[model samples]
Structures are given as structure tokens and as C-alpha cells.
Target: MSDTLWWQHGVVYQIYPRSFQDSNGDGIGDLEGIRRRLDHLCWLGVDAVWISPVFPSPMADFGYDIADYRGIDPIFGTIEDFDRLLAEAHARGLKVILDFVPNHTSDRHPWFLESRTSRESPYRDWYIWHDPAPGGGPPNNWLANFGGSGWEFDAPTGQYYFHSFLKVQPDLNWRNPAVCRAMYDALRFWLDRGVDGFRVDVIWLLVKDDRFRDNPPNPAWQPHEASINRLLQVYSADRPETLEVVEEMRAVLDEYEERVLIGEIYLPLERLMAYYGRDMKGAQLPFNFQLIFTAWNAAAIARIVAEYEAALPPGGWPNWVLGNHDQKRIASRVGRGGARLAAMLLLTLRGTPTLYYGDELGLENVAIPPDRAQDPWERNEPGLGLGRDPARTPMPWDAGENAGFTTGRPWLPLNEDRAERNVASLSADPDSLPHLYRHLIALRRGHAALSTGDYVSVATEGEVLAFERRRGGVRLLVALNFAQSPARLALPGDVAGADLLLSTQPGRDTAPVTAEWQLGPEEGVVLALR
Candidate 1:
């Protein structure tokens, strides 16, 4: 255990700043608010906190469209405020991970502003700029992830700039040596400030096809899907050159001590494995989002876990994500019962686990009215159910006004059941989801087998998914029931009986089991095999 890295065995908790807590009562969460809530994280037993971007931005894509790589947004407090938050988090033995958006910057950034002024501007080549096509349209047929063409025409420079996401976010030219130097400097700035590491945003999109070729059309595209999916994005992202960029970033992190680099990549498992780089020199943890996108059933989950375990590069680590700011809450995706089981599955699995801010309390997505919508994707493409506001809503801290997240008006509405689902109410109940999360985390930390053991898939009948985690002589068994009715699980002949260590259901029968065990609906249990 002394040789293991913190990220390898510890949990990473993601905090969406604006929705976390509002200290100044500006209807938005700030640095001080996060510092104030360090106690909550310590109580939850997470080892690290990964905060979304708080860099200065025009709010075009919230904080994702960074205006200044080195400055904190005034809305999120200044540089000094960030320092205080970092110090506080460190004092509590919790690592702080910043969201580094290296792929693009706000169109209003000084670099972009200077680049758009003239073709010969020293910074002109800092971004992806191309001359208009012979047909006088975008350089190619590439489509933006938000909508429309991926190229934004610049009237002053007579060129089209590429933006994989939004027009306000101009893609950086990672091919340019100068861009790499500057971004690396930005990384050093935070590292020097004693921050732990970064969760690089859209890391796969850092480099693009130098030819700027048109992406092939997606044959599986349906009208119901977002327009961006119309193309296969063959040339727009995940280019071969991207790995070089990732390797360069990894080199920067290597310059620091024990710092981790987590890449946010949304690719298929085969392609995603490459992000680990040769000998795991790339992202220490290329985020595993399979659980977020997979069907919440015993068979589907079991298959995915097995596939992911098999796909790991030699000595490469794996991670799991059940919910995030970008996705619907796990509680809403699976029912409350299943959310509890999912928690058990996440913490007990091998490798790291990243927990979204409010999921521990079983918080569901709040319904945002059409008029209150804030996500640019939802605004740019209305009625498509593409909005993320529901998932990014304020965290419910208490039953008081704004659910104790803010004294002023909350930027987004709270869950309709916040009165009962908040931390204050939930923490008081030992059977609450929050307590279940705490217990699971504690159990994982207390046992080496649960944290760093080898995973072995266990075959089970009906809707129960079972597995064994073994480290030397210690073996732990985990069984989860995905159905609404009781499910029976037969222990393998290798183990005749075991003592129950913990269960998702409160007050569940903990008597030692023989060769078989019965699991309640949506229940999961961890056992120390005899």
C-alpha cells in the first residue's frame, strides 16, 4: 500500500463550482464556498476533489471557454481565493484536481483576439485558421459538436477558424510549438501553487487533422440524434497526433512529484485504451465512462466490467464513473434502489472511482423550465433534450432556502424533493444514501482486497451480478441484485461460507452465509470469505 499512488486506490469527487455552494450569495458558488465545504468531503471519505473550470470566461460555455489560462474568474473569486481553497483542501489530506481546458479557449481570450486581428499577427497561427474553400463556405464539411459547421468564419482575417464545440470556443493549434509552450507554462503555474493535478477537459480533441479534411458521414445517424452525430468525426478529433500531445502533457506532470493526469476521453474502449500511452506514460486515469452510458442491469454491467478489465494495458490503471456534471444523475438513471447498488459496485471495483457531487444523496435531476435553461447546447439545439442544466443544478445541502446552497437566488432550481433529499436530512438517517456511500467508501479503504485486489467475475443466476476481489490470502465477495424481487446467489465451491462485511440495505441480515445467500431487491453485499 505504501508503494501505491493516491489516485490508484483513492476516490476522486468532482465538484461543479457554480452548483456546489455560494459563499458570497451571488447566486453562484465560489472558491470560499468550496473551502467551507471541505468538511463534507472529509466526512464522505473521498481522497480527492476535482473541480470544474473556474478560469475567467465570458460564460459562453460556462467556465469551459477559458478566457485566461492563469487567472481565476471573478465570479468564482480571484487567484488569492483559489489559493486559500487549495490550502484548506490540502490541510484536510484531500488532493485538489483542477479542470484544465487545453483544447480551446474563449474567442475573447487575448490570444484569440490578437490572432483574429490580422493574418500576420504573431499569434495568428495560435489557433486553427483556414482560408475559405473555393465554394466560399467553411473550409470543410465538419460539424460542430454544438451545431452547424465546425468552422467559424472570420471576416477581418478572411479565414475560417475551427471550433469542435461552440463558435465562442476557438480550438487551439496544438501543432504550433508556441501554443504547447504557453499551455505547459499554465500547467506549471498551478503545480507551483501546490495543487495536486488536473482533469484535462476534452483531451482527445487537443489535436485535429492537419489537412482539415471532411469527416465521413455517420451511416447510423438518426434524426432524433444531435446533428453533430451526423458525421463520424473521423478528422475532427482523436487524431493520431493527439497521443503526442497527451505525452507532452504527461511530461509536464512528470516534472512535478506524485501528481496525476486524468484525461476526459469519450471514445470506445479499444480507442480509449491508447490514452494510457506506451508503458502508461499518458493519462494516469483516462476517465472510464462506460458505466454512465451502459444499461443499468446485472448482465450489461458485468459484461462491461469484464471487458474493461480485459482491455487494460499492462500495468495501466482503470477508473469508473456513474454520474457527472455532463450526465443525468445516477439516481434518476437508475431508481433509488439501483443507485445504492451502483454505489457499491463503484467503490468495490478495482481501480479508482469518481463520484459526482450530489449523487451520494440520491439527488435526481431537476426539471428546468424552458425560460430558465442555461446550457448552450440546449439553447443552440432546443427540444432535443440535450440540455445539461438539469444535471448541473445546485447541490442540496439542507432543507432551508435554496437548499442551503446559497442565500441569494440559486442560479438553477433545486430538486423538487430537496427538502427531504438534502444532506442535512439525509445525514441524520443512518439508512440514507449518503450513509450508504460513506459506509461503502470506509469499507473499501479498510480492506486491501477491496482497494487493490485482482477482479474475478463470478457467474450467477437470475439478475444477480457477483464478483470476487482477492489479494493474496484475503478474498472478498460482492453480489448485487438488479431486479425488483429477491434473488438467490450460490457461492462458488471454492468458498463454502463467509461473514457479511456490509450491505446496501440498512439492517440487512448479516449472519454468516453457507453455500448460498438470498439478496433483497436492488441490494448489494460485500463479504469476507471463510
Candidate 2:
């Protein structure tokens, strides 16, 4: 990679605070917990840590529903704890990115409380508010992302307020200049505290249809799908006006030098590009969830990669994510064998890659029993198998009780295989996923072709995905077998034997390869073209 920008050349690791580690044995992860784990990330070879929200909140929707813009929740740690984390992270040459929730605040927030108290409240205009219809119902037909109506009637104010997810999270009116100023100040607050950047939550939902028009119905929505998908959401999400909101947010970020901004967006490739803003003034990277939802097939993944690469603005950097706090784990989505292939795909790609916590060890989703289910999304849609608790389970640090996450009863149950799949377990195994991840990371660090190379898809036999990563005079070939059955892939006719640099299979030598390579089931490798 060209050593121009750190973010451009680095891989990001995402940590869900409540599940990363528990320093005080409170059964919940805190800033101190994260600080203690800095060495782990350093060894993992990630350049930055993007932490989810740790702000003061009522836990209505975990930290996403924020009650305070500038303070940390007691369940986590204080501002001082966060500052110490930033200090230690920087000491290890790791950039820290905090989560910024700009779309809404908890109902318990002072601004929301005041706004809900009376129609004349000064902050009433700060949040989206609308009068009931002629029959005294919700202002519009918008549906909450979690479930039910997006509007919640506040009897005291004799009106309804908007929420995109949970009612407790009242959507802020970006149109309100006052709200914009306040949110911008929040960005400055963290920047002043030495955070490298922010991962803005749900940025595309910042603006809505000003006319308060009802969204159209989704004709193709399946009955088994999440209730929120019942509508087309034309008036509620991915609004064109949101691009201006992104520009404004970028302006606030511009106040600080060299600070990156990452936006959480889930729009299609075409619509997702707009978050870059009119003149490339938007977020440095709009978090790409393509890998999270894309079908785990060679052809499907190849198309997504090609399409996404083609869709980028002239200067926009690309990013890829396999799993996150809100989605199914990659290991669970694709089996253990597939995860290795995924790692090869993720680390060798052209842009930055964000690794979710515990993914290095191939942590699969831990099943949460009925009594243990904690995710609001799943709680909102019981029995539909939609809860996120499975993915957000506590990280398994070691083979100790409670997975060394907490001395007390963990906030969530340890996965069944923690003793075998933890950092300590896999880090020692030469062929383990964690070891493979470390090797891939270190290799990418030393090779421009693997880190920032121009990707060219290579034709291969069935279930075999081969691509060439080229930079300067270096060309590296990456081949992956998507299935468990062996597959024979024919290398390019113009190319001769290659020097094998690394392979998912254990103890594989960096040797010469022939025109045809037999790919072991779910095997992948990086080759230095000779």
C-alpha cells in the first residue's frame, strides 16, 4: 500500500463494548475492559479500533438510545476511563473511533424530556413532531425498524414524535438548525478528547420526507421477514435530502485535522455512494455491509465486489465487513471452513477491512435461550429467529470460567465452544483461524499488492474464485474454494508457476505452483506471481 493515509492502508477492528471484556467483573464490558485488551488488538495487526456507543443511556436499545451526548454510561466507565483508553490506544499506534449517534436520543434525554413535556417547550422543534391525523392516530404510516408504528403519541404534548427504530429513540429533526448545531458540538466533544474519528450511526436516516407522506407498500416483502420491511420506506429512509445532512456532518468533522468519519449505511450500491457527498466532503468511509448480507457464493460475492468497486466515486475508498454486533456472525453464516476462505477474501481485497471482535477465531453465533435473549430487535419480533443476541454474546478471552470475560455471571452466556475457540486456544494453533488472520495481516502489511492492489477477476472452474491483486510491478494471485468438495482451478495461460506465500491449510509451503492447482475443500491461498 502507498503510505499516504493510515486509514487507507489499515484494517479496522470493531468492538462491541458490552461484550468485549469486563474489567470490574460487572458482567458487562467497560472502557477499562477495552483498555486492557489493547495488546490483543495490537497483536492482531489491526490499525484502529472502532468502538460502538458507550454513552450514558437507559439501555432501551443498548447504547444506541443515548440519554447524554457527552457523558459515558456508568455501566461502561466515566469520561476519564475513555480518555485513558484513547491514551493507551495511541501508545500502541492504534487509532480509536467512537460511535456517534446522531439520528436520535433516548426518550430520557433532557432535550427529549423537555420536548415531550409541552408543545411550547424550546426543544420541541429539535425532534420530529407531528399532529395526529383527523382520526387522532399516528401522523404517518411509517414503520419502526424494530417493529410497530414509527410514531409514539405523547399524551402530555397532544402530538406524536418520530423514531426510526425504538420509540425511546426520538429521531432528531436535522432540518432544525439548533439540533444540527448541538450534534456538531457532540462531534467536537469527542474530537477534543483525542478520538481519531467517529462511526456515525444510521447516517442515511438523518433526513426524512418533509411532507410527512406515507410510505408505499412493499409488494415483495415476505410474511416471514422483519415487520419493518412491510413498507417500501420511500418516505422514511435513503432520502435524497440525507446527502446534504452528510455534507453538514462532514463539515463538522472538517473542524478537526486528519480525523476520519465512518457512516453506518445499508443502502444498495447505487444509493449508498451518495453518502460521499457532492464534492467528496462526506464520510471518509460509509461502512459497507455487502459482505454481511450477500449470498455466500463465489459468483455472488464476485459480482458484489466488482459492482462495489465500480460504484465508488473517483476518490472514495472502499471497505468490507463480514459481521457486526447487529448481524449474524460470519462463522455462523458460513461454516468454519468457509470463514477461512472469507478471511483470505477480506484481507486481500483492495480497500480497508473491518474485523468484528472474535471473528479472528471464527466465533460462531452462540444460541440464546428464551430467558437469555437480550437484543431489542429479537425481543420486538419474538419467535421469528431475529434476535441479535446470538451475535453480541460476550467475547471469549480464555478457557476460564465465564470465558474470562467476567468473574460474575456474564451479561450473556458463553458460547458452547469458548474453551476451544477463544483467543488463547486458536492463537497457539498454527492452523487456527486466529493464526491465519495474523499471518494474513502481517503479510498484507509488507506487500503493496495484497494491501492496496488493483483487483482483476480471474476465470476459474466451478466453485473456485480466483483474482489477481497487482501493484507497481508486483502481481499476486488469490484463489478460494467456496465448497467443501475439492475443485481444480486452471491458472491463467500466460502465467507460469507461482510462489505460494500463504494458504488456509496448515503448514503449506511457499512453493512453486503449476498451471492447474487442486484446491482442497474450502481452501484459499495467496500466491506471488513469478
Candidate 3:
């Protein structure tokens, strides 16, 4: 990490506002709700917070389909509420980053509304539109990420508007300079209001193939509730033209000091790095999602980590994520016990670590019953299980009515056993997940080796992951047993004397220094090397 860029070294906590806190008693969270939790964030010692979108929307996609670029949705609160939240965040010494959706807009947006009314409208070309095929079908064989054709037909204009997601979210025409300027202006609107940065959504889909070509069929069908991941979306998304737009956005960010832009790109590592731009003037951080895809094993994670560090461009920063609203919770994905090991690595890793809202309490996604499903993707395609409602459920703050989220019924059901896993309960227990998180975060903050150090993989084998973090002359080794039984791992030949830092092994004081160390089931240990 650069000494000048201190923000690059600390932890980042991601808050999905709708589920974080409910201040208005409407059973839905708002900006004011977030404002009330500034102290909690400060106590966690995170340097910044990345909020999911709170922009005006029709709720079709739960605020992802932005309807107004410069206004807050009524459900969240007014512009005044946002100002209060921003002020409180800064007061607590937390930098704020908003979710910026640049690739598409809600169908109900004024621009889209006008564009769809007539072909000659000035905004008609603001979005990608195409005529129907000879057989009265979609212009191409491209499929929506949420299922069905990516293009939605409009009978009035005899044309189809492209939507990479739901039909209601039409893709913006990045080819138009006006669209680029408009989105850039939107970023300025918030930056002017004291926002520290932005997290660009679906950034890889900002542009498309100039020739309206068909995406080839995907032979492997991995069914999710929204859409089948069977088709190769080559022409539909991750186009080469996307980088030009990123450069333009980065230029706008450059005008403001310390304003950062991060992007969400699901492409393979090689292609994902391209979003950073060849000139290294695009998004400040292209989210490293290897942990989300790789299996929970020492060798697998070590190899992926090595590959990602090697793949980064010179001077570019790296970021890591364990969970997001779009996917299953880290606990659910990597098993309940695996969550602790994952958290340790996330906080101690050599990057800007992003912690999902309730991850500190080891929150798992609540299982949503079919009748109560809220995600549009689930509603549109019943056969596929791509819906995100499981991970978007409300947070459990206390063991009280509505999990202390609200006085009334929540929009989504809380975990039935939330009383046992609530923050209030965990905060009282010395050995709770929340306490572990605080210890690890504090340790990371206090030790330079854990925060901005050069990461070196320590040699180990058999269900044990070990690595050494070094900065200046300080070096520390951290290891975790990821299996269900005791595993003996041999340390690298270079290791001499090591002082124990923290260990989850029961009844263990200091682990005996041997060529081989035995780790209990689902246990972790940290040591200072001499």
C-alpha cells in the first residue's frame, strides 16, 4: 500500500441498507437507519463503508434498476436524509462509497419513458434499440441474465430495447457521448456532496458488439432461479468498448481528490483485469472474486491468491470480497465453521477487505419459501433458482421483536434462530464471532505486516492453509485448519522461533514449536516469526 493512499490499507464494511436497520418503523431500512449505526461501524474499526444502491427505483430489482440518477428513493428517505447520513459517516471517520449503476436504467425512468414513446425522441438513441427478426422474434439469440430474451419488444415502435438483466432495465447506449457525460455528471453530484467513492455495477456490460450478433449457446446448463447460465454471453457483455467508458469515468474521478471507483466484473481473471484500463486510469479496484468461486481448500485458495497477485497491473490496487447481495452468504457457501477461517483471511489478507454487513455475526442466508419469494428473478423463472432474496434478508441486531430491525413485520423474514446469532448476543460473549472479528481487525490495524505487507505463501500440506505477511523487517505467519479433523502441516524450512498470537484450538496455550504443527478441526492460529 502507498503511504499517501492510507484509505487503501484499512478495512471496508459493505452495508445493504434495506436489511441493515429500520428507523422509520415501516419494516424497511432507510438512510436514517444507517445513520444510527455509525458508532457500530466505528467500533468495528473499518476505515470506509460501501453502501448498495439507494437511488430511486420502481423496486423491480430492489434499487439495482435505477430510475433517477440524482435523487433518493422514497422508501429509503429524502435527499435531506442522505445528507445526514453522509455527515454522520464522515463524523465517525468513515469514507463512503455509493453503488453506481451505469450500464442500464429502469424502464420507468423519464429518459426511457420518453425514448419509448417515439423513435424520433432525442432520448431514443440514448438506449440500444433494434428491429425484430424476419420471423417476429428477438433481434438476436442473446438471453437475459434473469432469463428469457435479453431484448424486450415494444409493439408501438416496432423495435426492441436491450436489457442484460430484467426487461425493465434497458441497457444504456455507451456509444453515445451524451450518455457517458450524463453518468459522469451523476458521479459528480454525489462527490460534490462528500461521497468518497463509487462501486460501478455491471461495468463490463456498458458496451456491446457494434454488429448485433447472436451469442453462442452454452452447452452446460447450470440452472439458477433467474436465468440459465448456458449461453456464452460474448457479444452481449464484457465488450472491448467498456474500457473506453471506464477511462472517461476515471478522468471524472481524478478531478476529485481521493475519490475511488471500484467495478463488479464476473469475467475470468485475465479479462477482469482489463476493466482497470491499459493506462491504469479506470476503476481504482476491480473486485477480486476468486474466493467466491474457488473451493474452500488451502491449495485451491493459495493458487488462486498467487495468480491474482501476479495478474494485477503495476500500481493497481487489489480488493477482496467474501459475500454480496447477489450470492449466497460466505457461511452458507463455505460451511458454518468455514466462515471463521474465511473471516480471518479476509481481515489479514493483503488488500482492501470488504466485509458483508452481517458477516461479523456469522449470518447465513435465510431460506425463502416459494410463496414468499421477493426477487423478480425467482418470480420470472420458477424452474431456475437464481433469486437473491436468501441473501437480502434483514439483519439480526438483537434478540427482540423483528430482530430489532423494526417494530412491524419485516419485508423479508429473519432467521428463525436469530436470537442465538444476533449482534447483541454475540457482543456479550467473549468467544463469539463478533469478538473474533474485532480482535482480528484490531490486530490488522496495529500490525503493519497484516495491513499493507508483502504476502508470502508459507509451505504447508493437508487441509492446512499457511502464509507469511511481511512489511519492513516484521514478519508473521498465519495458518488455518480447514478440515473436520486434526491435520499436521510442516512449516517452511526458513521458520525459526514463532510466538503465538491467537488460536482457536481448545485448551491450548502456546503451540509447541515443531517442524510439524497439529491443528484441530476447523481451527486457526497466528504466530510472530523471529
Top TM-score model: 1
Model 1: runs farther than 4 Å from truth? none
How far residue 6's Cα lies from its native spot in candidate 3, in Å, is 3.7
Model 2: per-residue Cα lDDT at residue 238: 82
Report the lDDT tens digits of candidate 3 across residue range 1-530. Answer: 45736457878888899999999899899899989888888877888899999999998998999999999999999999999999988887789999999889999999999999999999999999998998888988888877788989999999999998899999999999888888889999999999999999988888999898888877775553235467788888888888988888989989999888889989899998888897789888888888988989988988888889898888777888899889889988887788888888887778889998988888888989988899988888775567788888998989988889998779898988898989889888888778788888888888888888888887657778899999889988889888999988666677676777876553567855576667788888778887
Checking candidate 3 for backbone clashes, the offending pairs are 218-230, 224-384, 224-385, 224-386, 225-384, 225-385, 225-386
Where does candidate 2 stray beyond 4 Å? 1-3
lDDT string for model 1 (1-530, tens) is: 67689999899999999999999998999889999989999999999999999999999999999999899999999999999999888989999999999999999999999999999999999999999999899989999889888898888779999998999999999999999999999999999999899999999988888988888999999988899999998898999989988989999999999999999999999999999998788999999999999888889988999999999999999899999988998988998888999999999999999999999998888999998999999999997898999999998899998899999999998899988989899999999999999999999889989998999999957789999999989999999999999988788788768999999989988788878678899989998998
> Residue 488 of candidate 2: its Cα lDDT?
86
lDDT order of candidates, top first:
1, 2, 3
Q: Comparing 1 and 2 by TM-score, which wins?
A: 1
**What would the TM-score be for candidate 3 when compared with the true structure?**
0.97
Give the best candidate by lDDT.
Answer: 1
Higher-TM-score candidate among 2 and 3?
Answer: 2
Give each model's whole-structure lDDT. Answer: 0.92, 0.89, 0.86
